[model samples]
Target: MAKRQLVPTVRLRRLALELRQLREQAGMSREQVADATGMNRATLYRIEVAQAKPQGRTFQALLEVYRVPEARRKELTAILKSAHQQGWLQNTDDLPSQYAALIGFEAEAMRMLNYESLFVPGLLQTENYARAAIAGSAPDMSAEDVESRVIARMERQARREPPQTLKVVLDEAVLRREVGGPTIMREQLRRLLDDSERPDMTVQVIPFSVGAHPGMTGSFVILQFADEDHEIVYLEASTTDLFLESKGDVYRYRRQFDRLCEQAATPEATRDLIASELSGLK
Candidate 1:
């Protein structure tokens, strides 16, 4: 079996490496840093290796020990500020490490495009709908943990101003899938319509009739940051998450998204289709 994976993004890994370097510059051994920060030695090692996350206080203590210069200290702290970001989906640790980094990236994204073949996307899900969906995914989770995870995800959506120029091309089957049963599905569809109408967001559906097209391979999200030069593409699986940052790789996904968007119905038409289906749900 493939190993269970936790893929921290480049940003997180860089932070971890910086922390490790600071410790080394301070002439502190892992055990010594661990003692100074009141963290276990193994944890110190994990933090250095980018395999684990250090708590805020622990992180601050390490910085202090390293005597990070003022400007550099500010920069490191900003990276840690991302660590403090709590999205609506954070309550559950069931998300693999790599996926968690995607959440952080999502929180920071200014523009995002998603092509979903199955299920409603998280950023667009309602509380009841999201909670029910998450519960379905982790049947073994305790009721409380499910609630916590659901609340976190919902809150994540609320924490930021919704994406500027968010675009999604969803398959018609996703609307018809009946995920949390008819009632939840209906609500989910209605919510999709509501979100689509936002001035900066657009949603389109690719009708079942549009047989074979681009994006035949699962789903992908392409995020464009405020810094235009930093665009990225994210691909996820049950066990792993991949971020394509090379210009060539990112352009390939960008092209795929453009093609899928072309094959999808017009935004206004998609909203109308959703509304008609929602009425049928009633």
Candidate 2:
């Protein structure tokens, strides 16, 4: 078997899927392709599952075997090149393996639906606010490690030319909790107010009055890719991170997010709520 990728990006996974589809379309089985390409069947399987990155020559051979059109071949070849390129977060040694994968997905996600029940979503969090939250969550971390994590988190929010659509639904408690003290929390809230103005972003608050709701379980983010079939649910916990890719699981989370949006305050109303909290801080 081929050595697996430490952290496979969504593009890598998608490329793998495309390879499998091409092989199938050519009416060839894995065994036949493996034999023809002079590669191990197990290695081909790993490539198909995105557990291993395909070698440049192997990828080209498979494309040729599939008899892909010249134009499409060039496209897939380009994707193969990108799949081998390192992701922004791939080099951050301090990041957990699972978290690194999440960053990889977030980097290329076309849309993100995030529900926050505790502190503000990391992407919108102010620097000081993130530092305090990171420190509180992992008090044993060194200052340097903490700063590294903070920088990684803030980098997620850096504006792109065509910004990804971020629709955040925050629990009222998230706004009420003071993660970094009054000053930091105030600044964070103000930052939220500022981010809400972006044309591609939507910020909503699920007030306490909403009472019982599906999101009561915890926070989760649904990431949708340009390829609709690649939607995934990301669940973060103290010990491990869970990535849900099954259609059924993704659908359930998608529906839950839709419901949360319905139950949450409108964007304008959410801004008013934030303003109210900011005023109280002064």
RMSD of 1: 11.2
- Model 2 residue 6 distance off true place after TM-score fit, in angstroms: 22
What is the Cα-based lDDT of residue 93 in candidate 1?
35
> What overall lDDT goes with each candidate model?
0.76, 0.82
TM-score of each: 0.68, 0.70
* Top of the candidates by lDDT: 2
C-alpha displacement of 192 in model 2, angstroms? Answer: 0.4
User: Candidate 2 — which residues are off by over 4 angstroms?
Assistant: 1-96, 159-163
Candidate 2 lDDT score at position 23:
89
RMSD of 2: 11.2
Model 1: runs farther than 4 Å from truth? 1-9, 12-62, 65-100
Candidate that would win on TM-score: 2
Query: Tens-digit lDDT track for model 1 on 1-282?
Result: 996554444555557767865777788888887677777888787776556667778887888888888887886777666642322122223353345456656766789999999868888998888888778877887999788778778876776584456788998888887778889888888889999889888899999899988877889888776733567677766555566666687788888899998999999999988998888885
